[model samples]
Target chain A: MVPVFLAQWMKEKRSPYMVLIFISISIAAALLFGSNMDIKLKIDTFRGEGVTVEEAERWIDRLNESGAFIFSLRAEEESLADVRQGRSDMAVRLLKDDYRIIAVMESTNVELVQQHMQAVYHEEFRIMAAASHAEDELEFREAMKTYMEQPPLKLQSSTSSGSELRSYDMRLQLLFGFSLFLAMLTVGFRVNAMTAEKISGIWNRVILSPLTKTEMYLGHLTYSTLIGIVQITMVFLLAKYLFGFSLGHSFGMLAMIVVLYTMTIVAMSMLFTGILRTPEQFGAIFTSIVPIMPLISGAYMPPGTITNDVLLFIGQFLPLQHALDALIGVSIYEQGWTDIYLPLAKLLLMAVIFFGVGINLVERRRL
Target chain B: MLETVELSKSFKGKTVVDGVSLYLDQGESVGLLGPNGAGKSTTISMISSLLAPTHGDVLLRGKSVIKHPQDIRRVLGVVPQEIALYEELSAYENLQFFGRIYKLKKTALESKIQEVLEIVGLRERQKELIKTFSGGMKRRINIAAALLHNPQIVIMDEPTVGIDPQSRNHILDTVRYLNLEKGTTVLYTSHYMEEVEQLCKRMYIMDHGKVIASGTKEELGRILSSEDTILLQLDAYDDAFIEEIRSLDPVRQVERTDQGLKLIIAKQSRVLSSIVQSAERHSVQLINMHVHTPSLEDVFLHLTGRTLRD
Candidate 1:
């Protein structure tokens, strides 16, 4: 078993494919991080009719209360120039009779910013038209500001510790939440290699040796587990240094959850290896399945945002969801062992089942 | 010693290797010869214990290999027809990996790898990745990989296929050297009948999943002793003309070709006049002709009614 494991490592260390995979994962992490870091929602505003700088500032202040965007007032040309130059995220040119929005048509981020800016300005436009007097217009604006300022929902504490939930950057939250997805990418690579070996002529020679079926499965699985851990660990290290993302007081506990989650991923890799007939088959299956995991598991959304009970219930069973929950709970909420035991235990139980079934299937099948 | 007892294998109720039995004495090189899809590889695989045989048993030194495969694994090395190597790794690294799998430790493994590299003449550039090497060079390293642990029996399944002549010759010489100098038994399978004739003292010729003939090289050649093969090249010929040639006096059989025909004759001189008369009657113009001594190919063609490489 040791020799087989060592041989697997030696092949990876010597192969250019290994280097290519490392660079790809790093670039993927950096790209995901960069996309998150560079997005700043800026809502540029201008005065129109009775809409003075002071009145516009009031609306800007109202939007700023959410802390979800950067609000400012700029000239029509200057602000539109910023939009053209890709500096300011969005701009609005207000006239005596009507207002025009300026933004890049292509970017999805710009589209979202445009929608948010429209909601606020459209409300102001409606009130000013309905108000018939100067004081009435100002009074209506004030009422609308207060209405916007009101909290979306009443606050409540679900946990006993009463930890203040910090509002997270949506992209940053997803980047961390996808730690399992990112780790599984490397596991996918190892599974590809296993399929390649099985098809190659070397398999016959290796089978001629005295190695047992259990040893072969365990050897490849162990290597995959190590690779998953190492790749995920590298992403975390890069996050800490490059993004200043902290893992909080329970870093060790967080690391344990990641390792256990990685175990489940490795077992899944084995299961894929056992079921798929070829490397291309695994790749096709993986490409189809990879996006669906993060999609259905809510890795792309903020916690408490998955309002659908079915999605949340399904998330309970996904290892990625549990991993993200445990990571966020321990790192942001400063959760202790007792607080994280359920997810950790669920991940472990899934790991045992996956590994057990994977080994049993691979043993019975020639692959 | 390795012995296969009526080894047979079937897929979907169709037999690929049927009730074939053979043996390899210690330090002897035995060859399994057959055309493509004739079950040479299947037989070798079953013998190496890589594939399970249906309704058959294999014995290694009188111990049942089917029930206990590891008993022979310690002594058997298989070189499959396709390149069974990690092209990403260097030859030395590939050898070292296999040595470790064979349970060779430290100095023993290192020295054996170096020894095989020297033997296969890849020692100077052992550090280069196998993918960088030519087809023949890769084949040499493939064989070298099987020699690392110094197994008693080396099973080669067409290792020389698609290689340059020099590399093919080198592999043949190395197999011979291993048998003669190291006293390692070899079970060699091939498409090239000449290779088997040159390498093995005893050989089996197979087709359609069964050994059609098995004997020493000279003994196998005797199957063609009574008949002489006449190859006639022609300017023009057809199937009807071939049938006319087949009806010639003293002609046992006639196989059509691109030019003319291959006729098996009982007495060449007596049939020459009749063959010429038949060619004239069919208006088939003979360009060139040759008669040669019987070879293993003739034996295969005699028994299986097809070329060894067909």
Candidate 2:
């Protein structure tokens, strides 16, 4: 096993550029995609007949406070034209005491923008109604402002274990998703070298040696898994320290998940190598199939966003889904061992099953 | 010593190798000769334990290798027909890896690699990547890789198939040294009859998945002892003249050659006088006429009616 592993390592040492390129691509892609996650969505806003320009501007300012959706004040004609020309998904028409949404098409963004606007308008209307019963409008306004800042009755959302819930960070999810996705490419290509060796007759020469079949397989797989773990770890460290992305968890937990996820990915790559005939076939199929896993697993969006039963059911079989679940559960939700054991176990089971089936298929086709 | 008993292999009911039985004594160099698709590679694969025979037993020292392949694999070194080294790695690295897998210790492995490199005459270029080498150099390294463990028996399948004469001579010299000086048993296969003639004492000629003949060079040459070959060169000849020559009393077979005609006839027959008379009667010029000695090539042509390269 050591010999076989050393041979693979020597080959990589001679041409280390491929592995370095994969690592660089993983980091570059994560940075490229993660950088866009924080940009606020801009929407055009205009005033109605009962609303003055200053009132509309104030409403726009209030709407921008969440830092999610950006509402910029514009002329009513220009706002309507922006939506009609498809420059914006939706626009806002602020009334004196009511709000209206203008758009040419309905989408998830339109729905989210409308929901946020409704919440703000409902709260303001309730406050106005409460202030109507006061004798002095100015005093009531000042008192309401002070009271809202320091509420006597506060509702804090928490888990059943009494820990505060951490708001989902889409940028972190994108970073993990893109990093894992690219790491799969590196691992899959490394594992596919077995097939390439078989074609080139190197596998037969090794088999003719005194080394057992198990040792040869273990050698190749261990190298692939190690390389994968290293790439993911490097990306995570760079993300946490260099890119200033908050991991929000201990390095030890992240390390454990990286190992398990790398193993599962390596096994998955072996399964793919077994099913395909040639290295070219494996490359084409693996590259085409891997990009869709993050989508089906909801890696680009928050949890519970994918409500389609078929897609959710398919995501259950993918290792990436469980990896993301465990990673996000730890980094964002601050879940402990008990909270993540299921996903971790699922990853281990996948690794075992994939490794077994992959070896069987490879043995069956061995000449 | 090793032997195969009635070894046969089939793929999906199509037999590729059928009932091939051969043996190699200790320190003996034997050659397996055949054309393309003649089951030589298949037989070699079965003997090397790379493939399990459909029906046969390969006995190494009177023990069934099928039941315990490790017995033969430990003592056997196979130089495959393909160049199997890692192209991205240096020659020394390839030898080191193969030697390590054979369980050679580190200190000993380093010396063994250097020794094998010397044997293949590639010690100076040990650090060059395999991809940088020519086809012949690659083949030399391929042989070097198999020799790293110093196995008792070496099986070379077409090791000199496509190479320059210089490399081919070097390889032949290396194989001769391994067999003669080191006393390693060898089972060599090739399309070049002269290579086998130069190296092997005993040879097996196979065709269509069967060994048609096997014996020492003298014994096999005796198969054509009763017959003689005559080469006839003429300035110009017609089919009628060829037919007339074929109809002669001592003629057994007549084949048109590039120059004129070749005839297989009874040994010491007086057919040359009859051929000269026929050529005179047909007004054809006899440019040259010569009697040929029977070689392994002739024996092969007499038995299978095809050249070794066919």
Fraction of native contacts under 8 Å reproduced by each candidate: 0.80, 0.74
Cα lDDT tens digits, model 2, B245-289, are: 989999987777779887888999998889999999998999999
Please give the TM-score that candidate 2 achieves against the real structure.
Answer: 0.90
Q: Who wins the lDDT comparison?
A: 2
Top DockQ model:
2
lDDT of 1 by residue, A228-306 (tens): 8877777677767776665566668868987898888887777777777788988899768876787667776656657
Provide DockQ values for all models, in the order shown: 0.63, 0.67
**i-RMS for every candidate:** 1.4, 0.9
Tell me which residue pairs clash in candidate 2: none
- Candidate topping TM-score: 2
Q: Which segments of candidate 2 are over 4 A away from where they belong?
A: A47-52, A75-85, A93-100, A125-139, A159-164, B226-291
Per-residue lDDT over A223-261 for candidate 2, one digit per residue giving the tens place of the 0 to 100 score: 999888888888888878888888975678878998999
- Local distance difference test, each candidate: 0.78, 0.89
